[model samples]
Target chain A: MPSWPTLRLRRQSAPAAPDKPLATVETQHGQRRLAAVCPRAAAMGLRVDMALAEARAICPELTVVEADPEADRAALAALAAWCERYTPLAAPDPPDGLFLDIAGCAHLFGTEAALAEDLSLRLQRNGLAHRIAVAGTAGAAWALARSATAGAPCTVLPAGAERQALAMLPVALLRLDARMVAGLRRVGLKRIGELARQPRAELSARFGPLPVLRLDQAYGAAEAAIAWPRPPAPWAERLAFAEPIGTPEDLSRALAELARRLCARLEAGQRGGHRFAASFLRVDGQRPAIAIATALPLHDAERIAKLLGEKLDTVAPGFGIDAMVLEAEETAPLRPPQAALADLGKPQDTELAAAIDQLANRLGSARLWRAAPHASHVPERTVRRLPPLAARPAWESDPAVERPIRLLRRPEPIEATALVPDDPPILFRWRGALHRVRAATGPERIAAEWWRRTPQEQRPETDLVRDYYRVEDNNGARFWIFRAGLEGMPRWFLHGLFG
Target chain B: MPAPASLAVLRARLHALQPQAGHGVLPFGDPRVDACLPEGGLALGALHEVGAAGIEAETGAVAAGFIACLLARLPGIKPLFWIAPACDLHAPGLLAYGLDPGRLVLVQTRDDAETLAAMEAVLREGAATAVVAEAGRLGRIASRRLQLACLKRGTTGFVLRRWPHGRTAAVQEATAAVTRWQVAPAPSTAAHREPGPPRWRVELAHARGGIEGAWIMQAGGSSDAAHPLRVVAELADAAPAPAVRPGRAG
Candidate 1:
């Protein structure tokens, strides 16, 4: 197997001053200790895990700062995302590292050594102190990139040589806990080579399976998968420009070309994308991306370009973009268009789908929908919003009952006067206008759905009963008003409007 | 060339240029109302405007019902697009006007610009049989664009002039609509002291090449029956009150 593993280690420098010896200290058990030290501090004999007071005495010029592990992790993750320009399988390995699975991608950069050199050169240009190592296994590359035995900043171990390369490294490089390393050292096994020479059954029986599993992983006898930060898209197309382009026209032209290529691939596989995302990688390391979703699966290049073009203005080309990547984040199977046996001159389904896609992309998908009838007695709960293209559910309105043409989002409270307790209001004041009822329809009692009510709403005093009335005012404007509660003074509310 | 012969040739050329002239018309199924229109029906592949009259303009309930009835009268089972600034239309209520709720694609846009844009897009797609949009104001240029889009796809478009709550400024701007209507709720004739079928005082304020008229129209007979909005009586245009006012006993 052609196994290619890439390991990246970044040594964070103090942001204040690079020349001043700096040490980040953290409180542990009521005593502050050095969590990390800069290169200048290390050269001045200040070490991590040393007491902050002792370090200050050893190097009085040492600049002390509080350690922020969370920010460091977030910055590492962002760097990993930026590294996707090289390979989509780049993942953050936490605290201060990244793992890039560039197995088949090395040829694009000429060779494995050249790819590592390019990566390190870019890191150096960005003023980051980093070490990169390539090996046949992730465990071996990770160990070699951090160990002092590599002798060089960038190391490339050929395939099948991980066993020999990792033998001379200390047991600590096996990714074992500090207690386990100390225990192994007490047993006279200070190096991985000595541990490999010992009987595996005896070593595992003493230290459990962790040591054996990690040792096997480093020697390429087992596998270690990097936990990717983001799931790789099923289909993606990337373009790198010889000269950076920053104009809107150039960006849109590039996007259209990428979309055309992506759609062609989707067509060949008999699939359509439901969601597409385009990422523009700027020279200054800013990755601005825009995404669009369709209501129906589509593989049409022009349609995808049109939808994405509307959002091109939102992408800011900071210092010009050097590369671009388009990915189909979601896809589904769709057969190519075929001639129907009988064309009835009706608009094809795709025409509606295209219109829906355009509107949804611009105004948001939630804004467009088809109303479906829900099986509930409550006026508001009786209707449900469904996706525009969803299959229409069966709906049958009861002609015997009258429903208002316009239902208010919320019922507005009104003052009313009635002759009887259960009778319709003779006069009602709504929105500061009094309407004398000329004609009326009876009390259509719609009770609250007991089964759907929550525990807090099930109280007796909360009265969810309503008696609705269809009343026509003297001006001929009809309204659907209701009285809440079954007892005491009736509370009236105007719920809907009728023609 | 003879004068009569030359005039006939020019008329034919004009008709040929107007695409909607060949698309036919949408009849209200009532002869009295259809007679006021030049083509004996509302022109297809054109834009129409409907606004609520007087105090009823605030809610726009009556105007929405009139539009729903017109959409129901359209021939075919094709889907209808309804674009509005807010989604307050109760689907169940539309059934009363003979419009099936299942045949509706409702789009709630953020503002007037989005509503008009969505309407134009839907009309140009030619997938929907008709499109109804509730916008507070319609400029002349925007309405002309909507009409042109309809002409391209032979889709009918209706713009309902509606404003937000408590803001009842009337829309006075002229548009390129083939017909303009003002609908007000009229008192229904009481049947045994109960409210009968809803009535509307519908006024055809403008028609492209037809005479303007006003009528007191009642919406259908039975709830299940497809009552093609029948006219009860024609108004004098100057009269404020009809003869069928219910007595206020309270």
Candidate 2:
């Protein structure tokens, strides 16, 4: 368990003075109180939830800073992400603590006690005051880490010893609310051992079922689920260095090795990934990550490395990185490999898919698309964008209808005059230029889809009925113009340019 | 001065020195137009530049349509990449030129740099049969890079010059493209004062080993999708001039 607010202040303040005390204050129940205190302040008879005025009176020189729960939570979450270097199963225990499920990962650092010691030392070096307790279950570890009776800063409870170890701690360490703790104390139950001695039925009848459930959880008799910050990747490869490496060449080499290993694993499983993320853990506890996505499922190492190499410059090695982890976040089963025959005239589908991926990863997937025809009479609504490799149906269009090559995103209003109420324009002025219409085509009337209109457009005057015309100017430049509205001062607009 | 056998060897060497000599050609299928080109058609595995004449260069509608027709003539069902700064090409309009919208992969970029980069990448990949890019400017070095990429994979590239903001002096800068053209809308020969098929004044402004000429070209009728563009008449003032061979005075 980490005291987040003061830890954050300590981390922010450079070369913190040892004798000065620090406390973070917040308004609780309409009264300002100390939400968290540093070790010096705690030693000076100050506690969390104590009145701010009372704390100030006792220690007039206390460094009081306003508490920011949001910042503290964010810092805790970052720390949890950094802790992924220890185990992939790390989660932030809100407002203050972190939970690391290092069941099988302890062997990497030698033993559970050794791993706890290493974590505690690193936290201390980073200017954070924390308690590390390793146990058979998450609940037992969380409860033990917050208890003051735990002897050492790094406590490792042996298997099957949670009940004995938690007997003497206060019942509040079981994560009970203040009201429940007060109710339990009113019944002369001040310790977890006293609460656990009572019969389950009696305890449920007296203080509800929470106390019983919590006690069972602490003893490993019931499951305690932890919400992981990120779902563990299905496939991952990690590389740890004995000394920190920061040069670009070293990072690229490490990344290449990791990609090779990961791709081998994927090949063995007959799987390919669409999304891959690589995270670099720095010695200063910063995790810089870069992710790349493919247009199709891919398992080739060279292509993956090339795609990731384009983004390798973005990672900043602040104090030098010590570990790197590459994970495949999204994966799918791939088809079995087939031997190649003689070279055909047509390009392979994989070659096109690879090209699409290269461009999509650099310029974004939305920038690349294939056009698919839509069934609509409205010119703008006649086409939609689809993925580059999507199988599209044949596009069928009327051979007689002439459409402009380039369609403006929006229509520009123009001034035009005609001889009749519903005829093509004889003259028009567009973009500050006047043009005499040399020849004109019919008024292809197009009405707005009544079913697509909203209630606000239900008025009669708001109707959008357009009479489209393909007209040519004296200079031989053709334009697609439309006359909008059925009555009263019709308006002309230039919508497209003919080739 | 030389033996007959040595003359044959020298002729083979001359052919080898010609750019994209054996890569093949895509003819306009009109003798009037093809006669002006040294290879009787547009050279494959090379870069070509197309721009609209005068102020019409801003929209580049005519140049786009011309490139679409060229792409439709490319001899395979391989994919085609059309890279542009904006998504403005109307799919149905491309169908009018016999180019299928289904075979085109449209890539929209933020600026000219990205558009050129995508074009080079696609050309280098060698998978696509052709690549058409709509860009505002192409310097000498960029065009050379695109030409080299096309040469590597036997892919043809077309650069349609469009100045969406306004025309600038960059339009006149020299490039390494094999051919450069300028197209302007021309009056259609329709009866009874009605709009007819689209027509353009197509000018072969520059070619490596061909004569300069201009002609009145008209798009094919609605029924003729296979051969969509035909040369109607030649402009007397812009008629075919003498071929300007390399290292030779006019």
Candidate 3:
């Protein structure tokens, strides 16, 4: 049998305790003394759920405000980001929950219960109601916390040990339909322990795959991966808080621990990541987390912390936070050391890169990029824009033939009404401006490569030649102009201007 | 008590923090392009550029594409930054040649002028080997100012000029840039042929250490050295008959 908290707040964000609700306290002045008021509270003479209007008749005034889900989400995300200090695999469970995969990390954290106690104490300090449970499988832990609350020992099942681990958690932990649980109840199966003794075939025959699946999850037959509110982030560190943190400094220090771990991983992999996420969990059943993503994948602790700190103002911990998570997404291989001893060290590159990363994190990744190279001869086609720090370039990978220092995206047609047909243009009109050719150079005839030209590039053989000329304008400023025709015969076009 | 020159050199070397690339770091390819870089390549630091006449706002010519091509020639697994103005930078065409957007940083600024100043500051940081900026006009003093900054940080900066219709741009005689180039759209043949990259007619207008105009080289593509660049007019071109002695035999 399940018991909803008989006590409810006159106004509560979520349905107070679906499995075992929390006692309602309208105005909490101290930790131990929570003035109770609710349906069950009324029955107990606490009268929590009474309308402020009616409660005023019963009592006097009640504070009511629409729940800010955004705040809750931010806080949770901030907690998750903070959790990154422990492990990168942190995610918010939603409404008010967190899913941290501590696989292979139990020893590092000492023990799951210790980790849990750590969370509990932190939440208590933050004035939050934290119900933390660790189980062999996410389903088992979820079941244990939601179905079996308060002092119900969280059974740890060893590898291939879900059956033993989840045997104690109630069947309700499986989250089966109420009708199914009722049906099972009618059949005299109540606790998870009762169902565990039943044959799998009978359970399958009676409840279908769901029962079988949940049983398997509880017993390690199959794994139940929790559907995280956000995608599972890649993280390698975790810090279980001894005391929940409310200030930015505490949050920063916690994040630093995770950052250090991440830096180690990055150094080992010889890679860096631009986009990073940090999540936090508050103790007040409110989950507010912050995610900081950068434009460039970076590995400096101070810079990253500074960036996250800039966004700290955006996070409102409401009450306080218990745990924090930080993880990195969007990674690239580390740059090979190309340091050279020049006269003095320049901070521009690193500073700019860092600034860009912060801006990219604040803006969407799509908005920040570096110009990329394209193959098209068209000036515009030759240049591409891509996300910053997103590539391992092949630019310096060959003995390249000397290329023109000047390359334009599109050819500008010039009006050459006055050039002899058989020579480089001595004069031409372009962009409604006239340019007189001062010192003339021979036409460097460029023909399109036939083997590679597609139908898009096919033209009559006669127009195949491009007679280029380096003509110094009367102003002594040079212009690279070309004529689309045979030697001497020219159709002028202005290409590039020399600076 | 004068320190020996060797000792002074050793001390200088010892003070260095960021280690230099070992011989094994032989650039994967394109050593020539690397040769021009401070660390035999774009150093793992900042680079900057200054542009004038709203050049940064336009196709990002002075500020964006130039850097893309320069970086494209290197093959290390690092990132590049196109710090425009803390805003306003697009890189679609850049990826066609394989510069991943994920490895780029575009800092679009609110305006063109501000972007240049910020770019100078970024270059002074020394962490990046390059920084490019676009300003309304980089006069001699301004170019000199930026050049000094680049020299101090061991970074390189490219200043772009936007010359309006028929109006000549002001040229700065003093600066640290070893070369100045003007990028414009290359000419294309109207005749049908296998399509190829748009050919650019490079004009080396200025150079400090190397011969001016010596840098005029063709944009190498799928062609070979014998036919390094396209020479058009096959049908209409009258080839000089191969020089041959009149056949005495008869």
How well is each residue in A1-499 modelled by candidate 3, as lDDT tens digits? 0111211121235444433223433433432232333333343333434333444444333333333446556666666655544454678765456677877656666886666666567555644444666766777766766653445423343455555555656677676788899888899888787897889898888788788787776656687776554565554444567777888788888888778888788878887876667667666545455666654557887777777776787777767777766777678887776867881453235655665655555544565555556665433244566655544333332222212233443567777754457665567786665776556555666766566566754664333567666555554444567777554545577665432
Among incorrect, acceptable, medium and high, the docking class of model 1 is medium
Q: What is the fnat of candidate 1?
A: 0.77
Which should have the higher TM-score, number 1 or number 3? 1
lDDT of 3: 0.52
Kindly provide the TM-score of model 2 when superposed on the true structure, using C-alpha atoms.
Answer: 0.88
Query: How much is the lDDT of residue B50 in candidate 2?
Result: 96
DockQ of each: 0.56, 0.62, 0.10
lDDT of 1 by residue, A256-299 (tens): 99999999999999999999999998887788999999877888
User: Model 3 off-target regions past 4 Å?
Assistant: A1-174, A177-197, A201-213, A219-222, A229-234, A238-258, A264-324, A328-408, A413-416, A419-433, A439-469, A482-492, B1-134, B137-250
- Write candidate 1's Cα lDDT for B164-196 as tens digits: 878877549889988899999999997765788
Query: Against the true structure, whose DockQ is highest?
Result: 2
Instruction: State the C-alpha lDDT per candidate.
Output: 0.83, 0.85, 0.52
Docking quality band of candidate 3, CAPRI definitions:
incorrect
